[model samples]
Target: MTEDNIAKHGKKGTFQISCFYVGEALCGIDIGFVQEINKQVLLTSVPHSPDYVVGIMNLRGKIVTIIDLGKKLGIESTANITDDTRIIIVNSKQEFIGFLVNKVTDVVVADRENVSPAPSNIKGVKGKFFQGVYKYKNKLVAILDVEEVLENE
Candidate 1:
């Protein structure tokens, strides 16, 4: 944990989080939920799936649903795959899924008490999709509610 984290979290229980970006917004997920992170993985589109479902990919014989994190959060699709674009593979409710993010930032320890309830609207993303929000480096990192995000529409 960095001194900044300690200063901001104020001695509360802290845990590490994997930070990433969705467009320009900073976001994070519990490191424990993340299985792996891949870059530019080949994806096959799924017909009749939700608009957020980018496609599916085979990961060592396991089929994982690929979700465009931006689209899932009501942001526009990532038009081009750049070097920074990545797929964060996470296990939610026993199902493996890949979330496409603009970039993977860093892992930082966050104080539990520092997490506050999500605002009704955050960078055009609905609050229900967020578990909470934390302040980091003068910016807010929205902590993704993985279970809520994986729930069927």
Candidate 2:
């Protein structure tokens, strides 16, 4: 373990990204930060908010804002929502936001070299929301920045 070896190898940047479905489209998030998966409940609609902000919901007496992942990510939302559809809650800089998802997919690990920067021109001006894009299986999934994606809302 010498400085030369460290310098030559570079630092590892691999992340264990968890794949989740928003309709047929595939998407991923770094699993290290996902807090828990809670199913839907009585969400109180917050009036005068952005379209992406669906509303607020109570979780064990604490209120949480639900962010529509499909709307926020510029993807066709998962329709015909069922009992399996869940709310994936994550924390970024101490703020908690819930993403309405169709279902939870298995988690997979990716290497540092496999991660690629998001393209400059993502359709619908949504390119900036992603932290990076990585491959899981043969399909490409965007890794979203939880904080940046929810900060404005």
Candidate 3:
């Protein structure tokens, strides 16, 4: 991890991370960024939208753009929606966006010092999309860079 990232995500002592799966790879996001986690909701596909964009959903009167997290990260897309599928809603730049993940995992409290620089490639996901990797219970969780992931390709 860079000194700047360490200061940003680590200097705070420790922070909570919401872990989830995008295909077979494990991933996480800072809990502070998460608004809520919802079950598979009916999505209205947007014509001509980016391939990564699954669709939009009415989230309690609010419109949320749902993107397949796997596809966004160049991993396997979450094609088969099962009961385990979940939409992780996050507020970005005053707008709510949802990430469709394979399944929601556990919430972990990780020490900043434990976060390591991501490898050049993680299960086909580029390192640019990750802030770092946190290890927990013999598992490594790729920490998503929300801004990078949401950026227009």
Candidate 4:
């Protein structure tokens, strides 16, 4: 990972990551890419869009495309929008996009060296979406490759 993609913590090689849940699996993204986490907002359905594209919403005057992250990642689809549902907004390519997650978790401080490569068992399209996996509190947090997840299929 490049310095620009991760936010350095006090230690030279450590960084903070925003963790969240997509179904039962824990996932995370580099804190550097996150703009904000927003609650469920009214979404205007977009016709002729991809299945993963939930819809679009106006976030403080800016139009943002919201994607069902779980579905995009080949995880369980986020079919219900509950109180725990959140939209993780990220500024990418000068545009703002939001990832709809099941719930917002904690910000984890992890060492760059500790992140293990995406497991060999996680093959096919899903494997390409992960940057690596970091062990946090006895659990594995799959780190997402934002660019890959945001890329059009």
Clashes of each: 0, 0, 0, 0
List where candidate 3 sits over 4 angstroms from the true fold: 8-10
Q: lDDT winner between 2 and 4, please give it.
A: 4
How far residue 79's Cα lies from its native spot in candidate 2, in Å, is 6.5
TM-score each candidate. 0.87, 0.80, 0.95, 0.88
Writing each residue's lDDT as its tens digit, candidate 4 over 1-153 gives 335334432233887889998888788998989999999657999999999999999988999999998788777787479999999999888899999999999999989878876764342337668777889999988888888888883
By TM-score rank, best first, the candidates go 3, 4, 1, 2
For residue 121, model 4's alpha carbon misses the true position, in angstroms, by 4.8
Q: Rate the local accuracy (lDDT) of all candidates.
A: 0.84, 0.71, 0.90, 0.82
Candidate 1 colliding pairs, count: 0
- For residues 34-103, what per-residue lDDT tens digits would candidate 3 score against the true structure? 9999995699999999999999999889999999998888888985799999999999889999999999
Name the 10 consecutive residues with the lowest summed lDDT in model 3: 5-14
What's the CA error at residue 75 for candidate 1, in Å? 1.4
lDDT of 2 by residue, 26-60 (tens): 66777766877887745788899888777788876
Query: How does model 1 score by TM-score?
Result: 0.87
lDDT of 1 by residue, 1-153 (tens): 334434543455887789998988788997878999999568999999988888999999999999988988888676358988999999977889999998999998987777887788888889888777889998899988788888873
Report how far off residue 133 is in candidate 4 (Å).
0.6
Weakest ten-residue segment in model 1 by summed lDDT: 1-10
Which pairs in model 1 have colliding backbones? none
lDDT value, candidate 2, whole model: 0.71
